[model samples]
Target chain A: PSASAEAEARAHQTQLTKPAGSLGRLESLAVAFAGFQGCVKPTLERIVIRVFAADHGIAAQGTSAYPQEVTAQMLANFCHGGAAVSVLAGLLDADFRAVNLGCVGKVAPHKNLIDNTIASATADFSSAPAMTAERLSAALNAGFAQAQQGDLFIGGEMGIGNTTSAAALLAALFHLAPEAITGKGTGIDEATLARKTQLIGKALKLHRDQLTNPAAILQRLGGFEIAALVGAYIGSAQQGVPVLVDGFISTAAAAIAVALQPTLAPWLLYAHLSNESGHKLALNKLNAQPILALDMRLGEGSGAALAAGVVRQALALHNTMATFADAGVSHAD
Target chain B: PSASAEAEARAHQTQLTKPAGSLGRLESLAVAFAGFQGCVKPTLERIVIRVFAADHGIAAQGTSAYPQEVTAQMLANFCHGGAAVSVLAGLLDADFRAVNLGCVGKVAPHKNLIDNTIASATADFSSAPAMTAERLSAALNAGFAQAQQGDLFIGGEMGIGNTTSAAALLAALFHLAPEAITGKGTGIDEATLARKTQLIGKALKLHRDQLTNPAAILQRLGGFEIAALVGAYIGSAQQGVPVLVDGFISTAAAAIAVALQPTLAPWLLYAHLSNESGHKLALNKLNAQPILALDMRLGEGSGAALAAGVVRQALALHNTMATFADAGVSHAD
Candidate 1:
């Protein structure tokens, strides 16, 4: 009965103002939205982006390819309209909002911040994760309510050492060992990579029970930002708007949303495959195929945002191109 | 003087109703039009596609990646709109015209044939090339005069086992060994690659004198279609219409065009970087950067034609996008 809603969405998708299936992936996305909303002509109006950002205790472990400060720096850049996502969101005509779900001690609210502090990142998972379940849910609810107006919502994450957390969480969820999921996050080398993998292995043992519960798994190993993204994902589907799943970390959150409510998978459109090895696992878990395959690893919803541009073109082309019948070009081979 | 004319034509690429430089490669192409005519606001009207098609004598050598008949069959597909490029050009509003500069005996002309039946293809260089220098030049001249009214010209080629011909020609021209220039055309495997490289080595020895002149090069190892593309490139430059260079074979022709008159190089814009290894070498020789890098191996100007869409987007974006001041958005951080 639940699958029927997405199916209804799909039927409406083929009936859009274009030749059948002409827009390619965009047609699929429109169909996905139809399924999510259970509508024939799903609206994608009032687009909103809920960007969840946090700090990772794993940064103390020196796990990231970039310095931990970059997470805070980029978040500020997003607020100041100087980031790639800021420029791209302008290109996409999407409303861009960033929430400091958790960061190092609550800083003053910036222009993009729709939600205040959840905590300054998770506790260094090497000891114990920094957050409790209540904080994660509060942050999630705040971001979700802010996204209520949009018929399409996109969620992104900004956290130092988040990939380490994402890889650890994916390894546990998929029942694979760490190395299989870990990758050069922000471009680390052999020695640092080995340690990063080991740290995740150690964290799993410390938080086994919490890791079993999908929400608990997020709190146990995911960044506050990642957990908020999961909440946003779940909330968007509950609101009947299509939600675009960004790169690997966002996918990690998405996988949690799907696990909690299996029907949520129908609402998500994967933007692009990442250079992250864990992303392939996430895609496999969600049964999703992304549009672009360029080896992009940068996050900040850039993949999803860029992919939106392609999808917009696809829809326009699908809707605008004259069919053989209308063009009067003889169809005779 | 010829170089200046081509450069000026390139500079005048169409205004496309977008900001100048907003669409990058497309803007460059619009500029190519100005460079072509040495004027402003160049039109992309009256497109001419000089498809230099030739059957390689090497098809008999059984050293190609794909079967020889695939070439002739593919050419038939091109005329019938079953080939990808045929669909692409139609999609992009570019008028497509294929030429049969050379092919095997008794090859019939098809609907898209702009120039038909120049020769049945070059003779195997391993034996003696099929045509003399005078014959190659005559066929090339025929193609040059085929499309007199076109505002732009792009060269494409179809030849079974033609990569072997290309490698042999390149090897001879640069005085490099055959292996340095050979590639898996149409997907030949490792052992076959070795045999093909060995065969090219033998042909180079026999065709050494052919390197002395461009016509002699065509007579010795280059395909009849390639020679036609060379002439078409020159003719497009002469007529002040930009020339679009397709994959390896077309670039080979462009190489000959540039060698004959260095100024003709300015009249060309690379459409795609084909899956062939020799393509990069040719691009390096011309010092050109392709617009798209989608791992496209299906040649027939599919890459170039698809790139036409991107170029169009670039032009539209350039001409249409509101500058920061116009959009009322802050340009500074």
Candidate 2:
């Protein structure tokens, strides 16, 4: 991000016919784009959206409302343009793809589906580490390879029991109570929610010594898609592209990414606060202010895709609006 | 709004790809549009954006940050495609127009400018009624004439001291303390806010007898542009077009319109919560939940124009996204 370009954009906002700061956060959003693009006026003509799908072995404990096969099913749904993120990405004219990071069920080949399977599924974390260190590296490299240069990058996750993995990882990383971060992903019953919480608590106890750092925590409790998301975040930042982090699971990936590389913090922008119970807590840990809060918990990068429109509009306004001198408008008294 | 269509839309939502209610407020938004358009799936292809610009007599009391002449200047800006709403409307491909309800300064004619001048300006409301009953009727009729059949209707306002008028109207209508509703308009200083508050309190007392009804209250305290907005809101509802209400001043118009005809409430959807202090309180009075909260205080229907994009996306997803059965995806267990 260019500080000089940001300063120029901030000064330019004051001359855009409206009263200073009247456009509120939008004014800042435009300036942020200007900084990211290293120009006084930035355009968001290219948006790249990637959704990584895998299966969580924790689902073997009946942790999720849906069966693990749904992960592979949704990846097909994503490629066939039936998933929420697929619909939104099409609307946005974004470069959209689904990365198959090892789902339990078979996924058919499609133009939008990337075959990057690291394993059939992670090991159950309640008793064993979710993945070996080598598998974690494979998943991270798979995600890192997916990142390409674009105006904006959005990483989405699709896995049946990924939220359970996210909860356990976040609890261990942030030193939080498992109950504080556990939530009903894909809508679970009260008893299931209790069981899910207890499972995460037990996993935290199991991986206590190994949870010394972000990478160790992810390798112990994270799903392939989560690690891939973490890789994508770092990769996007490394490529000088801004990332719009999605809901709970995506945010968990972001926390891990930012924890590993603190400088990656400024390159990330939060998309929305979800209905997930611990999204706010996770976001607060990163001091993130999400752009939208519509109670959406469906994570296929849908939230980020919706916010892409807003970012586009903000840039459009910044680049197209006439200055006070150009519009012949009176300045404030 | 059609109850049957809304029911059908809700049912249709549950059958789509994602989990039930995973889309959050967007699901409800699509359902509402379905009800408004009387279809199971609604599409927003035509958007009409009208910005009413006038001068407030209250500006003479030194309540605003900008000169009264800036209203006419912004009217010109709106037509010339330079203002915030103008930029947004262009981006949304909306049919945009600026109606001159009465400005202190002369406004040049343009293809998109409507000459609906009710008077040079409203009378100084601190000393007398803002408009005569006849002039209020004229302003209302002008706004009513602007309402046309479109997929969506958005009403915007531009008056130098309109926030003072809005605060006064809301305080009197809701019977709240002057301090509770008064806010800094167009970025006024601390002293000006206090003065604005005191002046509104005084006007409420002076017009106590005449403020018995919505029409009377509007005639006594509202700007011409505000009256037109009220008329437009009612007119849009009558034409079976849903109205997306803009910021503080626009919400005041909605309140008056809803007060005159309670049925008009369902026809109106709030665009965004403004930086203005009284907006939330005003929205609460009508049970309105705005779609965006970017802290925008620039009222030219800018917020509504920005939200038009969101509404369009919502409808597009509703009308076009493939259903679960269509994609052969499994439902939750």
Best by TM-score: 2
| Ten-residue region with minimum lDDT total, candidate 1 chain A | A324-333
lDDT of each residue in A1-333, candidate 2, tens digit only: 889999999999988888899989888889998989999999998899999999988999998878777888888989988888888999899999999999889999999999999889999999999999999999999999988899999999999999999999899889999889999988999999999999998888888988999999999999999999999999999999999999999999999999999999989999899999999999999899988787899998999999989998888888888898998887888
**Segments of candidate 2 deviating more than 4 angstroms:** none
- Which model scores highest in DockQ? 2
State the lDDT of candidate 1 residue by residue for B1-333, as single tens digits. Answer: 234644553443221211122223444554555445555444454565545566877778877644554555556556666444665566656778776665653344767865556556667778887578687778678667754666667667777777787777666665677766688776677988888998888777776655686566767887777777777778877766676677777777777778788877666888767667777876886798875554555455655665555444333333333333332222211
User: lDDT per model, in order?
Assistant: 0.66, 0.91
Candidate 2: residue pairs that collide:
none
- In terms of lDDT, model 1 sits at 0.66
Q: Write the per-residue lDDT of candidate 2 for residues B230-320, one digit (tens) a residue.
A: 9999999999999999999999999999999999988999989999998999999889999899888988898888888888878777877
TM-score of 1: 0.59
Quality class of the docking in candidate 1, CAPRI style: incorrect
